[model samples]
Target: MAHLIFSEDEQRELREAARAEFPGNPALAYVLENLAAEGIDLDRGRDWEDLRVEAGLPERNAEAPEVA
Candidate 1:
């Protein structure tokens, strides 16, 4: 599976779109379901980096320059 990384602006836009399309905890339901399917329990207290690594997703490098 190819993972597409999004910049902050793109992420914000996508989130706003989701909210407009589906009201009331729209993304939360999907996120929780997928995480459960992946055997990721939020109660385990996993950090953001841990979640990304577990999900086989890429993490943005803070020191790296953004591609234009």
Candidate 2:
């Protein structure tokens, strides 16, 4: 499985910073390109709107039984 394993707090900060700074097309592209320059290859297919909605949520608080 090609699952992403981001540290929750770190990803939240990154997302928030991105939302704050990249409020337009070229700026957003620059941000993404800069991330890629640093070897952070994010999957484009991942729906960020969905991720943002869940970013404030704890991974353990889902309806599914917790995995240990």
Candidate 3:
């Protein structure tokens, strides 16, 4: 089992980024659920947008579409 944590700043950034990138809340929640089930715990916090990417979900850049 593993653990996940994030600083306040990281949490804020990921939260905002997810809101901007994901089309809706369900999408974001889905990613979070999967991560949690995978032993990824948001102790202090977590980088949800990054986790979304790890979960093979779409992600957006800060100023543009994601670059592969």
The C-alpha lDDT values of all candidates are 0.60, 0.59, 0.62
lDDT of model number 1: 0.60
Q: Model 3, range 1-68, lDDT digits (tens) per residue?
A: 34775666666666666656765676885575454344355464658787887899756658766557
Assess the local accuracy of residue 24 in candidate 1 as a C-alpha lDDT between 0 and 100.
81
Q: Model 1, residue 48: what's the lDDT? A: 73
**Per-residue lDDT for 1-68 in model 1, tens only?**
23345555665665566556657886675664443334434455658788879999777889867766
What candidate 2 gets wrong by more than 4 Å, as runs, is 1-5, 26-68
Query: What shift in Å separates residue 57 of candidate 3 from its native position after superposition?
Result: 21
For residues 8-58, what per-residue lDDT tens digits would candidate 2 score against the true structure? 566666667776677676678567545534435455556756785778754
**Lowest-lDDT window of 10 residues in candidate 2?**
32-41
Model with the higher TM-score, candidate 1 or 3: 3
Please identify model 1 stretches exceeding 4 Å from their true place.
24-68
Error of 1 at 52 (Å): 27
Error of 1 at 7 (Å): 0.6
Clashing residue pairs in candidate 3 (N, C-alpha, C atoms within 3 angstroms): none
Predicted model with the maximum lDDT: 3
